[model samples]
Target: MAKAITQIRRVDPTPEELQAQSITKIIGALAENGESIIKMLDIVSQLDQTGILDALDAILKKRVDVAEIMIQQMNQPTMHKIMKNGMNIFKFLGSLNPEQIRMLMDGVGHGIDKATARESDDKKTSLWSLGKAMKKPEVKESLTMMVSILEGMGESLQREKDHVH
Candidate 1:
């Protein structure tokens, strides 16, 4: 534990490293795995359209949609930064006793990661851009869906932060 702390103290990654080793990659890897499974099942779907339908699952079933993932990771980092400001940290630390700090950390710490938030925001950015890019029904539907999902996600995240405290 002590050694881990010393290592953490010694090496705060640069922005590039942080971005390079982010959860976007993990999500992408997961999406890629999903894509392979989808591809394996594509033969069946190609043979029958009725077998497969639904925007969310369909999109996620594809290989690493790098552009989409990139957008999400990009948006998330900004929010994490905003939340982790020195002043905010000090205030947060001050408000909590030792037990509260432990509890706050536990609440915030879960499976949640900086990349998740940024990537979600990235999806929103992608949707806005997507809406601008096309004049077709499918893209319009996708863009609209993305807008609703991303906006709802952002609101939920904000509310989680607000209410959790």
Candidate 2:
């Protein structure tokens, strides 16, 4: 009968072997991604030439200071008001119909152009001329829309007042 052995020995790789293995893997990866590595190097070279790399490095090194300064600036009352107003404007725009806004902007653009042309012609807008303009379909439609908007605004104000009381 053959003798039975119970001891199990594990041989760990030497430091040199591990280093060689890592180098081999890195070389394989570099060879496989040569095109990408070259493009990355080109971008790095351009950034360096423009001094952007140095600026980015400096910013990264002083990130805490940069963050604090930015925070301080944003914490100012004017900044707070600007941010609030911006958010309110965005919210209002989000609630509006895009097509209606587009049409309104187009009308405003045409009106400005017409007004400019009239000014260049040195023409005065008399009451009679205004009455003639009001007779136009476009003018009538615009007036109707304006009155509707004013009515809606008045109703909103009245509702807010009633709630306040």
Candidate 3:
């Protein structure tokens, strides 16, 4: 019976004992957080007392719950992590020996140059080449303007592509 009572006493925290333990923990925690908590409390008190809270309330009241797809798209941490991991893999690949990388590059590049050469050669023989080659003033002016716009668009596209990834 005394053993059961002792066990109960050992297991149970009395109100005073629990309170004392809680106060000790609080003191330890506060000691660790003393400076930061004081600053945070001061800042929060100022914000609440000095009408910043009112301004925040007004701002929130004005906001409609319109879900922005673009904002959500920008904040995709998973996609960021995936991209980061992929880039890390690429970097790990890049750190590999030059001979192996060169072999891989050579294997992948085998027909690529020929394919690109063929495509560019096809575009070289333009339909307008005959008309534009004649250099008629009207054709020349129109072609010049078209080429200028194409150049501008190409520059803009290249710039955008450069900035991306």
Candidate 4:
């Protein structure tokens, strides 16, 4: 027959034991990520050699001043207008179909190339020559497209004017 157990002891790790455990975990991590650590060190060495690390450290030291200057610059009226115009441009582009924009850009690029080639040629264009060009299917198609674009733009301007009143 054995006596009944009455006392239970809870053992706590000493400070030295805790420190050793933490060091062990850190060493294990270092071993597991040796290659990544080496690459990170190489990048840091390059940054230090370029003086970029010093610049970054200086910037961090004066972060509040830099932030204030940026805020002041952005608060100007010209900056506000620029931001508004940029937003409007983005909105207009967002409303357009990407495929249509691609086709228009391609046509513009070809037209620019043709114009550049013609620049070296000393060909003079007369009203008669222009009339002859109008007779060509490609020229007629381009003229029709231009007129359609002008009409659409005029209609939009008129609507904007009417809304303003």
Candidate 5:
């Protein structure tokens, strides 16, 4: 006859053993994150001492009511118009090229500097001086650009009207 080996049975932990194991795991975690837990506890203690925690709780409790009131206000016509105008302004800005925007800003700054210099001089330009300035290539180019922009604006307005109708 051949000898046979018996299979071993597994044992479940007792309630006391389970509780001790849980405590051990908790202690291990606390040891690993001791500093972080202390900081969190300090913050919570400060919040409680200052009554900020109660105020925050109160705010959170009435969040739905606050949201409803905000919604009601935002639904008004003036709010709608304000939001629409803000969105349109953003869309307009978004449509502009970055390089062109930079150029426009630079031009505005240069114009401001020129105006300040002119103010400090306090000298009035004669008709002859104005005529001579107008003949400059830079002035001519600027006037041409202005005229083109006005023409483009007129065309765009006409298209918008046609679309609306």
Candidate 6:
């Protein structure tokens, strides 16, 4: 009779070999991301060239003094009014719908264009010319829209008054 046997062996890498392996992996990663690293370095170089880094350093050095001065200015009544007005403007803008804003902008642009075009014409509008313009369909439509807008604003003002009371 014959007997068979199985055996296993293990090999452990030395510390120096492990270090070399790590270095190789690091080099491979550097190669793979070399372009990205170069781009980042270029942006940093631009920032340095523009003196932005120096400005940042200066700001950091005076941070405490700057903060104190800012606090003092903010404590003033003028600053409070400015801040309140800014908030109200933002609130008003927020209240407007995108379509309303678009229409407003379009109206402003058309008004500017008409004004510029009229600069070339030296003709003055007399009562007759005004009556003729009022008879035009486009002019009538614009006047109607303006009246409607003013009515809506008046209603809004009344509502605000009621709410305040």
Give the lowest summed-lDDT range of ten residues in model 2.
116-125
lDDT of 1 by residue, 92-150 (tens): 67876898558646645652575477677745556766566688775576578669869
At residue 68, candidate 2 shows an lDDT of: 100
**Following a full C-alpha superposition, what root-mean-square deviation does model 4 have from the true structure?**
2.5
lDDT of 4 at 119: 83
Of models 3 and 4, which has the larger TM-score?
4
Choose the strongest candidate by TM-score. Answer: 4
lDDT (Cα, tens digit) per residue for candidate 3, span 60-121: 77655333554576579987898899999999888789996686577458647865787877
Better of 1 and 6 by TM-score: 6
lDDT for each residue of candidate 6 in 1-165, tens digit (9 for 90 to 100): 777657666889999999999999999988999999899999999999999989988989999988899999999999999999999999999998989789878987998899889888988869998898999987898899899999999999999999999
Q: Give candidate 2 regions above 4 Å deviation.
A: 1-5, 113-124
Candidate 5, residues 50-113, lDDT tens digits: the string is 9999999997999999889999999999999999999999999999999988987898799789
The Cα error of candidate 1 at residue 140, in Å, is 0.9
Give per-residue CA lDDT, model 4, range 126-145, as digits (tens): 89989999999989988898
Query: What is the lDDT of every predicted structure here?
Result: 0.71, 0.96, 0.79, 0.96, 0.94, 0.92
User: Which of the two, 2 or 6, has more TM-score?
Assistant: 2
Q: Work out the TM-score per prediction.
A: 0.21, 0.72, 0.31, 0.82, 0.61, 0.70
lDDT of 2 by residue, 66-135 (tens): 9999999999999999999999999999999999999999999999998888889976789999989999
Candidate 5: C-alpha RMSD to true structure equals: 5.2
Window of ten residues with lowest summed lDDT in model 5? 1-10
Candidate 6 lDDT score relative to the true structure: 0.92
- The global Cα lDDT (0 to 1) of model 5 is 0.94
Deviation of model 3 at 44, angstroms: 0.5
